[model samples]
Target chain A: MRNSSLIPFRSGGGILMALIVAAMAFLACFALAGALGASKLAGAWTDGLSGAATVRIGAEEGAPEQQLDIVLDILKSTEGVIDAVPLTEDEVAALLEPWFGAAPELSDLPAPAIVAVTIDSANEPDTSIVQARLDGAATGAVYDDHGEWRGRAASAAHAVRSVALGALIVCALAIAAVVILSVRSGLSAQSANIATLRLAGAEDRYVAGLYQTRYFWLGLIGGIVGCILALGAMVSFDALSTVSRALPSLDLSGYWWFLLLGVVVFAVLVCVLAARITVLGTLRRGA
Target chain B: MILFENVGFRYGRGPDVLQGLSFDVPDGAFTFITGASGAGKSSLLRLLYLDDLPSAGKISLFGRDISTLTRDEIAWFRRRIGVVFQDFRLLDHLTAAENVALPLRVAGAREVEYRDNVAEMLQWVGLGGQMHIRPPQLSGGEKQRVAIARAVVASPDIILADEPTGSVDPEMAERIMQLFMEMNRLGKTVVFATHDADLVKRSKKPTIDLKSGTSSGGVAA
Candidate 1:
């Protein structure tokens, strides 16, 4: 009745509890967004390798060096082959060292050239024709189209994305629950105030509106703060550059309105949840 | 006007505090309800203020059946009735002026519009110098006076007070009673529950007597 405090929005323990829920809602959303970013980063790797393919050719070393030259000639004359580069002996050795020990126990190691082929989409070659011509014993050339591997990798990435998105939804529901619980507790604490309000001719809506607006602002302020902290963390990690793996970057440049809308809607929803619980609980008190 | 017909209440497994009670408070009349401790006097006041619903029978406020009204509708009807509790129940965070203006504020009247009225009401309750003081800082009598100011500030259709003068001295009690009288004289129906027989005799209002959980006198008038 007589509040001397300037920031006079105290509704006892209830409002404080509501604020706590609001903060939790914001943090939950923050965690959800982080998971989303992580999943997106994982998915970006497939996009990076979209336009590349590798061909591995295995041949006997005892066979004359003429076979290697023949394969190279055919690759050059091929319509879809924009360029073909064969790996040197040392380059092949370096690539195999990670998989096997570098020293060879036996001599005459039959090492075949690995060719990277780039196709000109304007004159795409028929893979079947290329494979049929190059699969002979002299060449032993194998076209290892990366599309199937890329597809599997993309599927894994999408799986991660789905799991992360699901986690985000659970977090949002957790936030909603916290909002409801906090509001109910807050209403309980202010039972006297509510009774006073009711007797003073303030309807349920008026009482609920007070809590709704208060929690809405709380969620908005907390959500924006969480988003800013998330962005700062992103920039900080990128600055470190220790993880060259591209972390999922938020496309925030043109999406400010979306973020604003998210903050507003998030705040409103949390507030509405809190207000609904409080109003219903108070009304049930038989006041 | 307010009326209760065959009203009864039992707070879930507890014995009935009010039972088979019937009373009508006429429009714009000042009345006193007197009883001993736990005599259901406060319970009766609770019914009029819409704080407790009748467990049975009917309660009429402004000629509408309160028993059938929704909580929202009851709240709306209650806005026209002001209540002062024994505990004063002033929101501890609000200033005296704000507390007094609470009724007007709840009614959605602009502060600019209600400023003069609230100021006059505070002055009438003899709390002019303490408008800025919080409830906790005020003395018992001062708090009681502030509560009285809040009750009548909105010029409500009815004012229900439960032992409003219970904590004040005789002199202060008389002052608070006079304020209620003035409000009633100005056309607001007034019902005050009190143990202070002296205050009741001094005001000379028609009295409703309750004893041992039952009305000792005739139906409320």
Candidate 2:
């Protein structure tokens, strides 16, 4: 009739359990955010590289200007090439400004003339055919489509996402372990009470239900607090981004709340299930 | 109704606490199990309540062998029997009213149905004024009363009490005995295990006296 008959409203061990659950939930939130952000970044990198290519004309015997025109003509004639525009000398200098400081001597350098080509999404250009056509018209020409860079970016993102996923899984197992240990301790602490209830005709399910209900509430409260703290951390980190570029700026604008809600629900379910299993397993063994 | 035939029990590799014991308690019989300390009174009671299985024997209750019942069934059987411990094993966090209503709650009775009944039962045990108080706040005699109230509140067919009045004063002991007697008169079988010889002589009930893991029957008039 009253929860007092089932379990104490507050216990030192129970408080410890709640704190453990909160810590697990907090870590889980970060893991989930990292996985989602990494996946998004990977998608952005892939999309940015998918439709573009670069054609470089080396400075040779003939004027580099004639060579750039020949490379552009080859690319534009290709079936899947959408557009081709040769980079102006000033534009090429701007690209090198990151490595070499801006100086009036930049024009004196024998930089290769480069043309940017946009490929049609519906029809991909056959690089082998374009390369063959360029070889005959313009010797020492090179085609770069950024495939290697895209591959490296995808691999890096995948590794990051994998680590985040692994962290989340470890957090889940840790939460379950905490619940099982806490419940076992609670049972030991309340053995006398449980014996009395058993003698009064309580079934194992009935007894286990009491602990399950208690854990459900404990997990819910802890999970919400953990989520709030995690959100605050994210906001603080975002704010720090204004002062320095070292901190990662998580784009919380998309579906982040949904992920948070999922984490809370998942935490609650883990607690309840863990408590129920521990209680039932102990009772069965005693039986 | 209970039957034990050639029941032998021991804890692990230790000596047998109950050796080849045979006994039967019929329905509606008020029986006392009298024995000195370490005479197997508690062990025998634990066997009767299905808390421990007899190492070697057959135990039957209500025409069904205990060994044949599943765990769930054993729980259901326990609902028809009530047990009161010598230490008044009331949950300390629960109020006297909640403690008394435990059996009913365990039976899955709704609060609306048993709330008033629990209050009335506590009142019958002279604990009406202390219903809201936890066991820690109750006197020894008051705690015993609450224990008794809890045992019989569900109107079980049989009540097993281990030294129900062991911790109370003489006057309170007699009062507790009267409550058990009242339940017996109302057609509930009552069994009590105690070393109290004077109370045994006064009650004049049939008793199974246990000595060194053996039992001898006696009747006092």
Please give the lDDT score at residue A137 for candidate 2.
Answer: 90
Query: How well docked is model 1, in DockQ terms?
Result: 0.39
Position A230, candidate 2: lDDT: 95
Tens-place lDDT per residue, model 1, B1-221, is: 88878788767779988777777888888888898899889888888887667787788899988777887788778778888888888888788898888777777777788888988888888889998888999999999888888888877799999998888877887777778887888889988899888877876778888776765564453
Candidate 1: docking tier: acceptable
Residue B138 in model 1: shift from native, Å?
A: 2.5
Per-candidate interface DockQ score = 0.39, 0.50
Expressed as tens digits, the lDDT of each residue in A1-287 for candidate 1 is: 33232223555644454455455545554555555555566567656654455667665544535666767777788777888877777887788778666867412576666887777655667777777777664456677656677678767767766776676566566666666766666667677877777777787777777777766666665556655555565456556554554554454444544644564476557657756676667666654
> How would you encode candidate 2's per-residue C-alpha lDDT over A1-287 as one tens digit per residue?
35354667456766787788788889999998888888888889889988998888876645988888778878878899999999898999999899898988988878888898899866878777788888889888888778788899899999999999899889889989998988898888788788788888899888888998889988998898888889999888878976788866787776889988888899999999999999999988983
Compute each candidate's TM-score over C-alphas.
0.73, 0.86
Could you say which candidate leads in lDDT?
2
